[model samples]
Target: MSQELKTKAHLIYINGEWSGADLDELEVVNPANGQVIGCVPNAGEVEAHEAIEAAHQAFQTWSQTTAYERAGYLKKFHALILEHQEELAQIMTKEMGKPINESRGEVASAASFLEWYAEEGKRVYGETIPTHTQNKRLQVWKKPVGVVAAITPWNFPAAMLTRKMGPALAAGCTIVIKPSGDSPLTAIKMVELSEQAGFPKGVINLVTGSSSKIGKAIMENDKVRKVTFTGSTEVGKMLIQQSAHQVKRLSLELGGHAPVIILNDANIDAAVEGVVASAFRNAGQTCVCANRIYVQSGVHEEFVDKFTKAVNLLKVGNGAEETVTVGPLINQASVQKVRHHVEDALAKGATLLTGGVSLENDGGNFYAPTVLSDVTASMVVMHEETFGPVAPIQKVETIEEAIALANDTPYGLAAYVFTESVSQGTRLIEQLQYGIVGWNDGVPSATQAPFGGMKESGFGREGGHEGIESYLESQYVSMGIN
Candidate 1:
C-alpha cells in the first residue's frame, strides 16, 4: 500500500488530471532518515494560473449546485478518506516526520471535517429582513463566493487542507489549493479522492511551486473571490499586503505562541498531562501548541519536576516506528531553529532540566524533547514561536501576573488555563485575549467549533457552521406584492 501511494505521490493534480510541470520538480524527502521519497512538480506561475482559471470556470456550475448535491459529494469524500487512511498516514509520516499514529489520527480528523461540513452545508440559511414598505417583502439568500485559493502548511497537512477545503466546497465554492512544498503528496492524493467522488472537472485543483509565485497568481486572479491560508505570521502579513492590491475575501490562520497557566489549586496530574500533550505533540510543530507555561509559585516546584520527568520519558525517532512519540524536526533548518531557541534560553540563564541537545547520531533531523526552568519573558524562546518540543516554565506569583505574561506576546491564537476555582477560571476566560481558550484541557477547539485568532495570530474562523459562512456571501431579494 505504501509503494502504491508513492507511485502517485510525485505528480500534481490540476483540473481533474494528474501531470508534471514543464518547470522544476521539488524533491520530497523523508526527514526521519533523510531519504528522497518522491519528486512533485515544482509548479510555476503558469501552472498556478492554470489551476485558478480552472476553478474559476467551474464555479459557475458548481455554485449553482444545490446544497443536497454538494453534500452527497462530500459524503463520498469522507468515506474515501477512511479507505485511504493507511496510505494517507504513511505519506504524511514520511514527508513531514510526524508519528504514524498521529498521522493516522489526522486523516480521521480530516474526514470528520468533511463529514461535519457535509451536513453543515444544508444549514447555510439566510434570514428575511423586515422593511418599511407595505407592498414589498425582502428575503436574503446565501450565495457561494466564487473561486477560493487555499494555501495550507506542512504540519498536519491532511487535516489542514481538508479543514479549509471541506467548508469551501460545502458552501458551493470551487477551489484550487497550493499545499506546502515539503508535503504536497497528501494534498495531491486528496485531490485524487475528490476526483473519485465524482466532482465536476475543474471544481478542484492542486498546484505546487514557489509559494510567492503561486500566492501572487492566486492574489492577482480576479476570478478568485476568496483566499484562505494557514502558515507563518510572516507569510500571512505578506499575503495581507498582496491582497491590498485586490480586495479579495481572505481567511488567514497564522503562527501562535500560546500560553498554558497552571494555577495553585489545579489538579497536578491533569495540568501535567495537558502541558506535556500541548508542548510536545507533533514535536511542537503545531501552530496552536503551548509556547510558555506559567506555573503559580505555590506549586511551581512540583510542576517543574513532573514536567521534566515527562519530557525525559518521551522517545524520539523515526515517525514510522510505532514506539516513537516525539519524531524528528521537519528538516535541518527546523532543527537549527529549535537548537537556536534552546541555546538562547540557556544562555539567558534559564536552567535546562532535561533534553536540550539534538540527538548526536540519530541519523535524522531529530531534536530531543526539552524542558527548561526559570524561563523569563526576556528569553528568545518566550518571545518567539519555537515550533519545537521545548517546554519552558515560568513561575508566576498570581493569576494577574500569569495573565500579564500570557498576553504580552503579539499572538492571540489559543490559550490554556488549569484552575479549580470558578472565579479564577472566569477571570482567565475574560482576560485572555486569545481567540480560543482551553480550561483544564490543552486543546479547546475542534471540527464542531469556530477556531481563529484575536490579534497578530491571523483572522477568520475555520470550523463548524461559521466555517462555511466564510466562503459564502449574502444576497438580498425583494418581491413586490401584486
Candidate 2:
C-alpha cells in the first residue's frame, strides 16, 4: 500500500482566486502515519472577513440568477468531482484515515448531492392560495437568503461539504465555507473544482482555521444571512448563542448517539452485519454511527456471538491497504475519547464481548472494533455520542423497553430497527424520537431524502426538498384584482 499523499497548497479560495492568508500555515497531518501530508492556511479574522465580504458582495447578483443558471454551474461542479474522483479520494483518505475505497465511494455518493440539488433547484416552486373573495388572490415566492456560512466537520469531508454547498448554491445563495483543519484538502479541491465549473467570483469561498475567531466573525457579520454547521453538540449550541443577536437563519447537524434495536424476529445475521457497518464504518467517526445496540433478550446471546466474531474479523491498519476495514481515528484525541468511553463502560459493569483496546503501539490513532455486552442505561456509553468504533449492546425484554432506552439520550439523529414484521418496524419508527430511521437496512445516505435530527441532535435538514428551503425565506403576497 502506498503511503505518500499529495500536497494541496496551503491557500484560501476567495473570490475565484487562490489567496494567501496573513496567518501562518497549519500543517495537515496524515492521521494514519502522523506525516505532514500538506498544509492549509490558518485563516485569521482578516481572511474570514474577506471571504464573508466577497460572498456578501456576490450575493447581490448571484441570488438573482435563474435556478437554471445556478444549476448549470452545479452540474459542471458535479462532473468535475467525477473527473478527478480518484485524486480527491486519495487526498481524503490521507487527510482523514478513512479506508481508500470508502473515500472513493464517498466522493461518488457526494456527487449525487450536487446533481440532486441541481435538478431540485428547478422545483423550488411556490404556491398560490385561494381567498374567499374572488377578487383576492394570495401567492407566495421563495427568495434566496443572501450570504451563507457553511462550517463543516472532517468526517465524511467531501459528502458533508457538497451536501451543504449543493443546496445553498442551487438556491442561489452565495456560500463561505470553513472546513475542519484535519481534512481541508478535499474541501479545497472541491472549491477549486467549483471555480473551474464557472461559478461567479465569491459564489463560493473557503477559509481554513481559526475556528473560534472565524466563527465569531461569521456570527457578527450582518452580511452573512444564514449559517449551516456540522459538528459537536456543544459547538452547535455555542454558534446558536453567538448568532442569537443576529437572528441568522441557522441549520445545524450536531452530535448523535444513534441506537440500533435488534428484535427477536430479526435475522440475527443481517442485524449483526448492519450493526457492524453502522458502528465501524469511517473508523466510527460519524455523527449518526450506531452508538448503542439494544438486543431482545431472546436473541441476545446468539446476536452477541455473531456480532463479536464479525467485528473481530475486520482488519485494522492504515486505510491505504485494501484489506484494512478499520483505519486510524482522525487523531490522538479520538483515540483518547474512544478509550474513555470503553473504560467508562467497563467501570460501570459492562462486559467486553469482543475488542475494547486501542492499537497505540501500531503508531497511529487506531482502535479495535469493540463490542461491549452487559451494558445498561447508567453507563456513559449509553447516553454519550461515542463517535468511534465502539458499540455497546444492552439487552431488553420488551419493545417498550427498547424504545425507552433508545430515546433516553439527548440526541435524536438517526435510529435503526431490525425486524421481520413490517408493523413492528413501523411501530419502532413512529415511536423513536430520531429524525432519520432505518428499518432492516442502514441509510447509505442518498441525496433524494431529507437527513437531519430532531431535538438537540440539530436543527434543519441537509438533503432532499427541504435542504434548499433552509437557504431561502418565503414572501407572501396578497393582491386584490381590480
Candidate 3:
C-alpha cells in the first residue's frame, strides 16, 4: 500500500459548498494499482437542476459586474491555483493515474489558463461598426451568454476545465461544469478555490454523475444558454441534436486520429522522440494523440528501429512514482479497447515490432507501450483512434501518398509533419486536411491559437480570441439622429 493508494474525500461543489446528495455513489479507482481511492457522488436530475438554477441566479449579478472587478477576483483565483498546485497535482495523479511529472505539468498548464483569461477579461474588446453616414454610429459590444454548461473529458481534466472555464468567466458567464466522473476530484478542488477567490455565489458549480442522465439534463435545460463540451465525436453529435430545439450556442472539441509524417530528409532521432511523446503521453488517451505514423520509404527501416527501441525501454508503473514513464489507462474499458485494436491489427497481418499485450504483474490497467510495423490502410489500428499506447507505422513513397493516407480518416482534428526542407514542410501544411498542423514539430495547441476540428471530429474552437466569441451572441444595433 503506497501513499498514492490512500483513500480521499469526494464531494460535489455547488454554490460554494461541498455537499452530497442521496444519489448513487461511484468509486474513484487508482488505475495504477486497482485501489479504491475515493467515492464521488453521482448527480441526480434534481441536483443537476439545482446547479443550473444556481448558475442562472448568479449570472444575474455576475454579468452585471464591471470587467475590472471580475478580473480582480480571477487574478486572485489564479494565485491560489499556484499556491495549491502540488496538492492538486497529487489528487490528479491518484485519481486519474497520470505520471507525477505529467500531472504537475497539467496543474501548471491549468493555472496558466486562469492567469491568461484573468488578463483577457479586461481585453474582451468590442468595436464600433463603421457607419455609412457621419451623423449615425453603430456600436457593437460583447456580453456574456448567461448560464453555461461545460462538460469535459477525463484525459486532461484540469487543463480542459481551465480552457472552457477561462473564456466563460472572462465573458462574465456563470458555469455549471459536469466533469468526467472517472476523474472528478481535481475539478472539485478547483471549484473550491474559485469560491475562496470571492466569486459570487453560484458563479461556478460542479455536478458529477453518469453521463447520460447529467448530459441530457444540461442539454434540455433552457436556462443553460450555451454548452461547451470536450469528448468523443459520437457524444458530441448527440449533444448537438439535443440542444437543437433551443438552438443553444455550442463549442465542441471532439475525437481525433491525428497523423504524423516523417520525411526522408528530417532528423530521425528527433522525429522518433516526437512521435513517442505525442503518441504515448497520457497513455495515448488524448484526443490529439498521434495515432498514424507515415515514414518515407528511404528512412522507413531506420525510423521504425529507433521508435521500437525507444518504446520498449519505457517504464510503466504507478503514476505517483517519480521514475514511471507510462501510467495505466483510465479504466478497464480503455484497456480492453486498446487490446481489441491491437489484436485486430495483428489479425490483419500488422507486424508487432515491440509490444502487443498487457502486463499481468503490474496489478493495474497497464498496457505495454506498443509499436507495430507493416500496417496497411485496411487495418483497424490504422484508421480508428486507438486511445492507448500503441503506434502503427506505415511506409510511404511520396509526400502526396502520406497526405492522402492521413486525410482518409473521418477525423480531421490535427496532423504533424516533419521535414528539413522549408518547401516540403510548407507544402505539407497546405495539403494536410486537419484543422491544426505542426510543421517540423509535435506541438498541438497553444493558448493563443484556435483549437478545434473538422469533418466528423466536431466543431467550434476552444482557445485564442476566437474562443470568447463562441460564448457571445451577436446583435446588430442601428441608430439614427432625427
Runs with alpha carbons beyond 4 Å of true place in candidate 2: 1-9
Clashing pairs in 2: none
Q: Rank the candidates by lDDT, best first.
A: 2, 1, 3
lDDT for each residue of candidate 1 in 15-100, tens digit (9 for 90 to 100): 78888746677788888887777778888788888888888889889989998999999999999999999988998998899999
In the order shown, the candidates' Cα RMSDs to the true structure are 1.6, 1.8, 1.8
Better of 1 and 2 by TM-score: 1
Best-to-worst order by TM-score is 1, 2, 3
> Candidate 3 residues 1-482, lDDT tens each?
24432323367777877788566788787888888777788776778889999999999998988878878887888888889888888899988889999999898888887777777778877778989997787987778899999998888889999999988998899999999888988888888788778888899999898788887789888999999999999998898889899999888888999999999999999898888888989989888888989999999999999998899888988888998889999988888999999999899989998878898745789899999899899888888898999999999999999989999989989898888999989988888888888776676578867889988888888788787778776666778876
Q: Candidate 1: TM-score? A: 0.98
**TM-score for all models, in order of appearance:** 0.98, 0.97, 0.97
lDDT of 2 by residue, 1-482 (tens): 14444444468988878877566888888888888787778887888899999998999999899999998999999999999999999889889999999999999989999999999999999989889898999999999999999998999889999999999999999999999998988999888888889899989999998898899889989999998999999999998898889899899999999999999999999898888888999989888898999999999999999999998899888998888888999988888988999999999899997778888634788888899999988888888877889989999999999999899878999999999998988878899999898888865565888999999989899888989899888999999998
- Give candidate 3 misplaced runs (Cα > 4 Å): 1-9
- What's the distance in Å from true for residue 268, model 2? 0.9
Give model 2's TM-score versus the native structure.
0.97
For model 2 the local lDDT of residue 157 reads: 89
Residue 85 displacement in candidate 1 (angstroms): 0.7
Candidate lDDT (C-alpha), each? 0.89, 0.89, 0.86
Per-residue lDDT for 403 in model 2?
Answer: 92
